[model samples]
Target: MSGEFDRVARLRAIFAGAHRGVILGIGDDAAILAGDVLATGAVLSTDAAIEDVHFRRAWIGQGVTWRDVAYRAAAAALSDLAAMGAEPRAMLTSWAFPRDVGDDVVDEIARGFRDAADVYGAPVIGGNLARAREIGLTTTVIGAAPARAPRRDGAQAGDVLWATGALGEAALGLAALEAGIAREPDAAAFVSRFVRPPSRIDAGRAAAQSAHAMIDVSDGLLQDLGHLCDASGVGARLDALAPTREADALARRLGVDARALLESGGDDYELLITAAPGVDLSRIAHPIGEITREPGIVGATTARTGFDHFG
Candidate 1:
C-alpha cells in the first residue's frame, strides 16, 4: 500500500485534527490560545529570535555579556504581551546553541532570563535545548486580560495619540555599538536600552481601561503607529509633545538625519496609544501625539514624519 503523501501533508493532517481551543492556531506571526479557568478569555502569544536576523554577537564586542542578551529577549516578548494590554503570567523559553560556546555562557543567559521574568512576575515554565550552528531563543508568554481583549483595530477617528518614554535612543545605541564608539555616556544609556529594554506593561494595562487603541513600538514609532491607524481606519496628527532629546544630539554627532532616524528607527518597545479628543492624556506619563480623521495620514509638527517598511 502507498503511504500518505509527503511530510507537509502529514503535518497538515495533524494540524487539522488538533483541538479547536486554538483561537489562532499557526500561520501568523504569533499563536493565540484560549485562557485557563480563571481567565476564561485570556490570550497567549509567542515569538522567536534567531542569531543573525534578530541580533549579532559582534554588536556587543567584548563589553556586553550573554546574560544581557537573554534579558533583552525576555523583555521583548513581555512587550508583546503589554501591547495587547495583558498581564504576563508565565513564559516558556527554548534555546539552541553552538558547541563552541561554553556552558558558563548558557548559564549566564538563563540567569538573565530568570532575572527579567522575576522583575515582571512572569516565571519561566520550561524549555528545550539543542545543538546548532548559532544561538536562538524562542519565548512563549501567556497573559490575562478582560473578556474583550484590546486589539490594533480599536482606534477611532479623532482619537488622541501618545507614546511612552523617549524615542530613537535605542536605534542610536545600536548605531554607536556598530561604529565602536564607546566614549559617550548617552551611548551607555542607549546600550543599556539595547541590553535591558523596558516593557510598558503597567502603561498598557492602564491604557486598556480607557484608551481606544494601543500598540508597542517594536518597529519605528511612526511605522507601528501607522499600523494602528491603518487597522482602525483613521489618521493621526502630532501635537507639541513628540520630540526625543537623544534624537537631536545624535543628529549633531552622527551627521545623520535625526528626523529620518526618529521616523524609521526600530526597537523602542514603548506603547503608542489613542483615545477620544477629550480624554486626559496626562493620566498616562508618556504622552506623544494624537489621532485625526484624515485617513492614512500621520502629520508631525517637526520635519521628521513616518516610516514605511518597503519605502
Candidate 2:
C-alpha cells in the first residue's frame, strides 16, 4: 500500500456494498448510530493500541508504566467522541494480556482506564478479555450526538479553520521518550502530555455552535487537515499559522524544526474546526487558516502524511 489513507480507500472501493443500518461508516472520526451499540442515533468510534506498535514494553522501567499505557489508549479512543461534537456516555474496552503477567498488573491497567474514563464521565461498560503474546487494548467510545453532527465533509470554501490548543504537544513528549529524556526532570511536562493525552470534549461541544465541520488531530495537524479538506472537496491556507510555544522551545532544544513537528507529528489529539463566516467561533482554540478552492497546504513548508500503522 502507498499509505494508510490510500490503503483504506482501496479497501472501501473493493467493498462498496452498503449496509442499510449504517448512518456513517468507515470515513469519519466515529460512525454515527445505525450499526453500533448505543444505536439510538449516538456516535461511536473504536481505537486500538498494540504493544511494540503504538508503544513499547521497554518503557515500563524507563518512566512509562503499564497503567499509563492503558490510560493513553483509553484517552485516545475517547478523543474520537470529542471530534464528533458528542457528549461522552460510555466505553467498551477490550484488553489482551499475556499469561506471564501477574493479575495485579491487569488490575492496575483497568484502574488506569477507569481514571481516564472518569474524566468525561464515561464509564467502562463491557468488553472482552483474551490470551495473547503481548498486551493490546481496543476501546470503543459511545456518545450522544447533537442535532446536526459536525461532519468532516461539511466544510466549505471561505470557512475559517481553528484548532484547539497548541499543536505537537503530545509529539514533543513522544520525542522525549524516544531520546531517553523521559528520565530528565524537565521532561515531565512533555512526558505527561504524551502519557495523559487530553480529550477536547468541551471544546468540541462549544465549536458545534458554529462549526461547519470538525476533526480530532490524532494523526497530526497537516495530515488530519488534509483529511478534512479531502472530505469537503476543498483546500486550505496556513498563512495565519503560528507554532505552539512548547513546540518551538522543544524543537530548538532538540535541534529540529518546530513547524515540521507541528505539521506532521501525530498524537496531539486536539480539535480542528471549520466555521462559517460571521459565526463567532470558540476562543478555546487558536485559528489556523481558512478553506480554499484548491487542494493541499499553503503558506509554509511542505508536509507529508502523519503516522500510519501500515504505511
Candidate 3:
C-alpha cells in the first residue's frame, strides 16, 4: 500500500470508537450521526489553520508541537459553537501536508484531535487527507444547539456589555514569541493563551440564558464588538477597561500600550455578551461596558483592528 493509505489506516485506528451520537464513524464513505441530537436544533461551524498564516512550523521544537497545532485548530472551530451556546456532538478534520510527512507526525496530530474532542465530548467521525505545499487543518464541528442561542443582532441600547476571561494575554503571547522572549519566566501565561485558547462552552450556555446578544472574542475585542454593534444597530461605551498586572508589565517590556493590547488583541476566545439590567452573569463574566443609543463605538482607542484575511 502507498504511504498515504498507510497513514489513513493508522488514523482510522486512532480515532476508532462507538459514539452513541454517531451511527457510523471513520472508515466509512461518510459519517452518519444520530438524528435526535439534531432534532431540536444543530449548529455547524468550520475553521482553518494554515502554516505561516495561523501558526509557524519553526516554533514546533521550541514551544509549538504537532499536538498543539491540532488542538488549536479544533478549539478555533469549536469556539463558534460556544458562541451560540451549543453542546458539541461531533467533528470532522481535513488535513493537507507535504508528501514527505511521516506516520508518526500524523499520529501525533490525531492524538491532538482526540484530546480536544474528549474535552468537549465531541467525537471525530470523519475526515479527508490530501497533499499540499503547506501543512493545514480545516475542522468542522457539529453541535446540539441551545433553545435560545444568542445572536449578535439582539442587543438593546441599554443592555450591559460583559466579557469572560482576560483580554490581551494572547496578543502579548504572540508578541513574546515573535520577539524570541517567549521563554522568559513571566511570558508563560501569555504564551499559553496564544498556544491554547479556550472554548467557553459552559460560559456560552450560561450567557445564552440571559444575554440579548453574544459573540466569541476571536478577533480583537473592539473589532468583534464592532461587528455585534453593527448587527444590533446600536453603539457601545467602555466604562471600566483595565489589563491584568501581568499583561501590563509585559506590554511595558514589549514597548506597547497595554490598553491597546486589551482593545485590539485577538485569540482570547472569551465570550462578549449583552444583557438587560439586573440580569446576573457574575459567575461567568464581568461587566465591561454598556450599549448606547449612539451609532458608533466609543470609550477606547483602537489604533488597529483585529485579524482579517484580506484586510
Candidate 4:
C-alpha cells in the first residue's frame, strides 16, 4: 500500500507507559496537576462525539460496547493538540449515558478512554457524567506547547503544502463499516482505519519546526486546506493526489469516485502543512501542493465538497 501510514505500530511505540504531569487524576472534584510541567506554554483542545451522529451503536461491536467510540473521541481531541505541535500532559472526558445503561457498559467506555490516553502518555485527569437519551462523549486534552506553536495563519504564498498520511483510507473504512462489507483484505483494512484513526502528534511536532502553517485533516483535505488558506490569507494548488490502491479498490466497490473520497472524505486526522521548499518533512509527510496568492483551491481534477456537520 503506497503512502500507507503505519499508525498502529507507531502508536504502540508511543505507548511508553508513564503519565507526565499529575498530582491527581480521575478521582476528585477536579484534577490536580503540576502547573510547572508545561513551563513553555499550554495547549488545550476539546472534541465531542455523539452516537447516531458521530457513530452508530450497531457499527461498533454490534451495539454491545462503546470502547472504540470513546477512544476515537479522545483521538479527535488530541489531534487538535497535534495541530498545535503540543505534547499531551493530561486529559478529561465527560460522558453522557442512557439512564438504563449497565455498569459493564460504562466500564468498557472507561477502558477505551484509558487505552487512548495511554497512547499519548497522558493520564485521564477528570470529567463529568450525565444521563441522556443517547450516549455521547466530549474529550479535552491539555499539552505542553513550543514557544511558538504552529498556527494556521502563518502560511506564505509560495510555501509547499504537505500531508502527513494517506487520505481517503478512513473514509473508505467508514463506507465499508456502513455497508458491512469487509470481506476483502482491503475492506477490512479500511474498516480498521475508520475504527482506530491515529493522531499525527510526532509528525506535527517535526513539521512545526519548519512548517509556516499547519492544520489537521479531520474535515477532509480540501476543506481543511481551504481553512488553512483562509486563515493565512492565501490559496492552494493541489497539483497531485495519491490515494492508496486499497482506498481506490474499496471506493470502486462502494460505487464512489476514489478521487473524490481522497479530496473530500473526512475523519483522516492527518496533518496538512505549509513549509518552505528546502524544508524536509519527507520522513513524516509528503508534498501535495503549493500555496497560492489566489483566494481558493485550484487544480483538483474534480469539484469536491467536504463533510458539513449541518449539511
Please, what are the lDDT tens digits per residue for candidate 3 over residues 1-311? Answer: 14767777888888887777799998869999989988869899999999899888777765667888788889889999999988999999999988777777788889989988888889999999998998899999999988899999999999999999998788888888877787788887788788888879999988888889999988899999999999999999987588888789888998888788899988888899999988989898999999998978888876548889998
lDDT for each residue of candidate 1 in 62-123, tens digit (9 for 90 to 100): 44677788888888889988888888776777778887776566667777887777777676
- What is the per-residue lDDT of model 4 for residues 102-142, given as tens digits with 9 covering 90 to 100? 66566667777778888876777777767789988998899
Q: What C-alpha RMSD separates each model from the true structure?
A: 8.7, 10.3, 1.5, 7.5
lDDT of 2 at 30: 48
- lDDT measured at residue 73 in model 4 versus the true structure, 0 to 100: 82
Q: What stretches of model 3 exceed 4 Å from their correct place?
A: none
Question: Residue 13: error of model 3 in Å?
Answer: 2.3
**TM-scores of all predicted structures:** 0.81, 0.84, 0.96, 0.91
Which residue pairs does candidate 3 place in steric collision?
none
Better of 2 and 3 by TM-score: 3
Candidate number of the best lDDT: 3
Best by TM-score: 3
Q: Model 4, which residues run further than 4 Å from truth?
A: 1-18, 62-65
Candidate 2 lDDT for residue 187? 69
lDDT: worst 10-residue window of model 1? 1-10
List the candidate numbers ranked by TM-score, top first: 3, 4, 2, 1
- Candidate 2, residues 247-305, lDDT tens digits: the string is 67776777767677778778888899999867766567767789998987787575566
